[model samples]
Target: MLLGYLLEIVKDRDKAEEHLVSIFETIPQHIDRITGDGVNTWCELQRLARTYLAGTMYADTTSEAKFPNTANKFSALMNDEQHAVFCSIYYYGKTTAQLAQELGKTEDLIRKALREAFAIIRKAS
Candidate 1:
């Protein structure tokens, strides 16, 4: 499932496989942190995988690149900022800090945008 998720993000099986390898390489460190009450294993693993891929992900993006094929009605419902923030973290595997820096916003604002984006998704669903 993780590999499928990554493959959806990267649109490249080899890159997705590499990221999967890298994520699994460091999973031991995250396992304890994710093993708490109410923890969602799939969500936690996705977050961890995103973090590991964040640095490498943006390196592959071009300014003219279109929105990913994975974009759905949920994403279409977002405002531009919300879409950018959400897609960057949710698909491109960016951290809030990275998005904050890239967008010239504070971390709080980036987080807020992410929250708003999720809210939109939840509401639309």
Candidate 2:
């Protein structure tokens, strides 16, 4: 399921392979901080792949006409911390706890960062 979803989003086989390699290397360390051994990482990957595909499809379909200049405006408005947190969670699949540990911040702080990042991204669209 995850492979199919990733293929849909990435389209190119080389890119999909690269994504898989990156995810495989990163997910274990990130997930280990939030979950004990025996967690189903494969399922988590599937969920992420599905989510990314859905979001990409939605944005591609709706954003062009709704907000023509949103990409540049939002990129300029995003704070470094917010962007880092967003990438850690969305692109690298880190949980709040994992992100907190990496940043030496509390879980609450990581969650706040994620919320702020999402708010900016949402407003841009």
Candidate 2 clash pair list: none
| Model 2 lDDT tens row, 1-125 | 44444443456668777666665665565575336477676666665453444444322322123222222355456687776676555544457886788788999988898889879978988
Q: Candidate 2 regions off by >4 Å?
A: 1-13, 17-76
Candidate 1 lDDT over 1-125, as tens digits, reads: 99878886778899889889988989888888777689998889988877776677444542425446664678778888888888777776667887788889999999999999999989999
Alpha-carbon lDDT of model 2:
0.58
How many clashes does the backbone of model 1 have?
0
Quantify how close model 1 is to the true structure by its C-alpha RMSD in Å.
Answer: 3.0
Q: Candidate 1, 120: how far from true, in Å?
A: 1.4
